[model samples]
Target: MHFSSETRRDDGVVERDFTIGEIPGVLWTPEAAPTPVPLVLLGHPGGLRTMRPRLAARARSATRDGLAAATIELPGSGERPRGAKVDAVRAELRQALQTGEPVTPEIVDRLVLPLVEQAVPEWQTCLDALLELPEIGGPVGLSGGVISIGVRLAVVEPRIAAAVLFAGSFVPRVVLEEARRVTVPVHVLLQWDDEGNDRQVALDLFDALGSPEKSLYANLGGHTGVPAFAGEEAARFLARHLR
Candidate 1:
């Protein structure tokens, strides 16, 4: 991992922007923290530029609780080149929405699955670099999501002890099957009336999770309607498991 810049926040947190080969990312650590603090990996909702404020807030919250936090730019996002596959997928997704067609499993598989596949490796690579840092320790946690990558990681990554999933995205049938194997503690958040999402699908996805310690937080309003307190609740959940 090659860090390009490091910033010290007024709140006594240190933020470092880095790149591991083609992947770009940011890591945050509390100032004067002891070595080997617990770490949390944050997943964004696609656009890194727009997502930074929210990501920073969550990182700060984790730091306050003595946990290090980090996020990697998803494939084909940020300064990375928008490859043909991603462009085609974006166009298809937009067309499906514009034509008022529901995003079916087939559609999600074709348009979103590839991105999910690409993202998992990037996140794994980020985790490899993060865990190597002297300031980060074991019992990693995952927070935020569009759903797919979180489910994939939770099922396959043993280092992740807990997850806080933002489940407002479509889930392919294959992903649902894989979700049945995710046994880590998970806290799933759903915006009850999100216009852009299928509420039944979100509920069904939550139901399919095989974790014995899964909890659901469903609230009213659209995608952005997640109340401030919901984040507090998620922080508590991660703290319980990670700390």
Candidate 2:
């Protein structure tokens, strides 16, 4: 859906607009509440994409669970216009490849990493905006497409209550080890398929997690299907924890 000017549910949850750096975001919450409601910030996967259905489903579920939920259209998604700068980056990557020269780590770090870095602060700034709401609580939960990097960014802010990582991968072992410092609970959902990462390996890795309340849920299908389970489990988990 195109961004609304201001939207509200019959139950009194209001949807408001926010801007994180250059990125645009939206937050939803009940108009009347005794305290700040718990929140879940839904994040999109790597591709240039939008998952409005998934986000809407989560928002509805969170509303029922006495929590607030917000969905952000990441840097490249939604109505925001992309500029010539991005084209230049792509052109450089193309030129390097066309010349048969190896793409060095420095090139990737300098060019590609900045785009991803730009996205991280938008998520954090969205969380910052959500926290500003009168009905939102101190800690928030996240379910993102890029789990490893997402977790790194989320943990930077201690206010995050927990995180539900959906089929996340590409975790640096050093970073994964350091993630144990995150005090909040994390529920990692994984899919078992030859096309996907080895589900068992991912499960075992999370099973060894240092967080006190870490858990794992495994099922059939690819990256997208496992979130169906995360959707159900997230509702229950939020009720038990956030409530």
Candidate 3:
């Protein structure tokens, strides 16, 4: 990982822009931390530029808790090259949602499964690099982003001590199948009134998880309407596990 730029914020959070291979990413660390700190991988729905503000906010929050945070562009997101096949699949999924049709497992699998396959390794690899930084040490946590990716990482990435999964997107069949193997503590945030999500499936996904220490925070809101306190609670959950 090569950090191309660095800036120290007024709030004492050090922000750096980086690239791992062709993947663009950013890392945030507390400027005056006395000791080495934990790390949190910030997950998103694939648009780094559009999502920067929120990602930065979460990173700053993590830094406030003496933990570093970082995130990279997902496989076809931001300036990364995207394929026609994924674009076509996305269009089909949008059309189905618009037409009020049930999103078939085939559609979800075609769109998200490959993303999970590609992203999980990138995260693991990124963790390898980010942990190399002297300021970020030891355990890691995952926050937000695609729920399926979070579930898969919590299952496969042994370094992930805890996770906060936002159930605002579709949980592919494969993700549900793998959920039972995720043993790390998980805090799932479900927006009960999200227009684009199936509430029942989100609940089922929560029920399917195998984590002995897991909590579901469901509130009446849309996809982007997660209450501020809900976020604080999720951060506390990660802090508890990582500490």
Number of clashing residue pairs in every model? 0, 3, 0
State which candidate, 1 or 2, has the greater TM-score.
1
Cα lDDT of model 2 by residue, 1-243, tens digit: 234468776767776665555566666676776788788777675322356656666777777777787766655445766546665765776797788765554554455455556666767777776677666885577765666555666567676777777654345454456566666787777777624354554665576466798777767676667556557886677567666
For every candidate in turn, the CA RMSD to the true structure comes to: 1.0, 5.0, 0.9
Lowest lDDT 10-mer window, candidate 3?
A: 167-176
TM-scores, one per candidate: 0.97, 0.74, 0.98
Location of the lowest summed lDDT over 10 successive residues in candidate 2 = 167-176
| lDDT (Cα, tens digit) per residue for candidate 1, span 1-243 | 999999998999999999999888889999988668999999987777789999999998899999999998888887878889779877888899999987777888887788888898889989998899889998899998668999999988899999999986577678889999999999999999988888888888899899999999988878988898998999999988998
Using TM-score as the measure, what is the rank order of every candidate, best first? 3, 1, 2
Assess the local accuracy of residue 229 in candidate 1 as a C-alpha lDDT between 0 and 100. Answer: 94
Model 1 TM-score is 0.97
Better of 1 and 2 by lDDT: 1
Superposed model 3: Cα runs more than 4 Å off: none
Off by over 4 Å in 2: 1-4, 10-12, 46-49, 78-116, 172-174, 194-201, 204-208, 227-230
